[model samples]
Target: MAIRLRVLLALGCALLTAGCASGSEMTFRQDKRLTIVSPGTGKTVRLPVKVSWTMRDFTAVRAGSPVRAGTGYYAIFLDKYPMAPGKSLGSLVTNGDCAGVSGCPDAAYLAQHLNVFVTSGTSYTIDAVPSSGTLGSSSHYLTIILVDGAGRRIGDSSWTTSFTVAGAAS
Candidate 1:
């Protein structure tokens, strides 16, 4: 009976491990130019931005570009969560928290047809504030990436910042 129990346990463990490893790990790159500004406190932190990407079962791909998926077939996801440690995540998707880890994801964010409150071409301008009108924490991190059906990485982005929370209205 013990032998049978051990065999069952081993099989269960194997299945779990296989499931976790089924997804291919993506590669990430970073841009050195990063700027984070705080409002009331008037503080700013300068840092770098990193990006991750994954692709799988792509129907087509541009040279040196991410593989492509047919319409309604699949879509690329950018981890809006920082994917970095000590980073906080928000329901608003303004921050990411899966940093420095592989296969461990926080939230899957779609890069298509999503609202990006940014001034620059592709950056989002986050404007979250506290009701007190008092300046508090500053900025949040966001992850951006692309992938194909084959679960291979194409590209991505990452950044962290501090911002002053707004105070209550007068």
Candidate 2:
């Protein structure tokens, strides 16, 4: 009787532990894709253009919120590739204001530009305004990644698209 009771107790504990595991502990599906819908690749556009994209199979949530299974936020990468797994999106430069600023200022600027929380829907739009004084023509690359609550990138665009910024130059 004692041995049987111990076995039952151990089984109960194992089930409890499994149930307590957070969503972050589970493996996220990689079948989702992030696609840029606006300002198509190789196209020329004026300043203050609208950038849009679509994501599938992943639930979009507000940053800093409790992460749910299969739910996360988006991070925009401009002119750079997405960070590797386990890298924090906060380290990347996503806006022009980050220049000449150190520490919090830089982080604040990046936070504003890079991390985009989708309150609802799979499609999102953001404005891209040129900060460069002169912009006769410039090639800009954009990509996005889906990050879990822990700031780990779980999904990303396979390719970065290039678009030209015209009329921004003096």
Candidate 3:
């Protein structure tokens, strides 16, 4: 038993060392890029839904922090992508209503009004969603975008997936 434990420990150490040598905390697949891990496309899910995703070469930072290279938070859009003519969700909330003020829309406003949830983590749990237009279930789109600390989008780093909510009849 002791020898076996030592062997396991040694293997774990070697793997850790290899990962450190690679200089990346996580190993990502080239083709895998940014992808949703659960509640797959076309799958039906329940409320308090858990959504997870994975990305490459990026770090999730807390909102309102100073913008750092390769470090940002995620903006999750449920149903429709909040767009007002040429304005974005962040811009509209910041420059339009709030008038370019810092922390204008805030987190609560985003979730309650716009269905836009923000998080620094890799996963988010949706407590509730809109009712389905049809009977039984409804399809919704989940869009995840990497945004900077100031709530602006970072380049074109965005991913989208569709799923159904069971028992969300209208």
Candidate 4:
């Protein structure tokens, strides 16, 4: 009877392990690319512009409290300069906790000047209108980047394009 009980326990453990092993393995690649689809470079457009884009290889997943592998989100940097491609964007620090971080701005500052967070999607269309009275007619640079589950930047960092806000002084 004891031998039978031990066999049953061992079988259960093996089944659990086998079940886990059957799931798809995580794969990593360095060839992911992001391309802006609308707002042709240097094109003049009005406010509340529609921005669209496409991505390859990367998977978009809702960001949870705990980040998961191969799943993350995207951020749009409007009119903000971009870091060099492949450079690391360290921890995402907001105004509430900008201590010791150079160039760190608070949440309100970012919200007004930067769209630090956007929803996760393989392809997305965003209605981008600068907050009322926030931006004058001017040429602005837009950049898109992929951030991993851990809030770390992945893929090329300098994927940027530019467009002019119609009527904004060039």
Listed in order, each prediction's TM-score against the native is 0.25, 0.57, 0.70, 0.56
Worst 10 residues of 4 by lDDT: 85-94
lDDT of each: 0.32, 0.60, 0.76, 0.59
Model 3: CA > 4 A from native: 1-32, 82-89, 94-102, 133-137
Identify the runs in model 4 with alpha carbons over 4 angstroms from their true place: 1-32, 65-69, 82-110, 122-137
Poorest 10 consecutive residues by lDDT, candidate 1: 70-79
Ranking, TM-score, top scorer first: 3, 2, 4, 1
**How much lDDT does candidate 2 score?**
0.60
Instruction: Report the lDDT of model 2 for residue 47.
Output: 63
Residue-by-residue lDDT tens digits, candidate 3, 1-170? 99999999999999888756554745543344678997798788888789998887888888888988888888888886644322344664543666656666888878987789999988999998877522234788888877877777776545778888877774
Q: How many steric clashes does model 2 contain?
A: 3
Off by over 4 Å in 2: 1-32, 93-108, 111-137, 155-159
Candidate 3, number of clashes:
0
As a whole number from 0 to 100, the lDDT of residue 34 in candidate 2 is 65
Q: For candidate 3, what's the RMSD?
A: 14.1
Clashing pairs in 3: none
lDDT (Cα, tens digit) per residue for candidate 4, span 8-50: 9999999888867533574444443677777789787786667
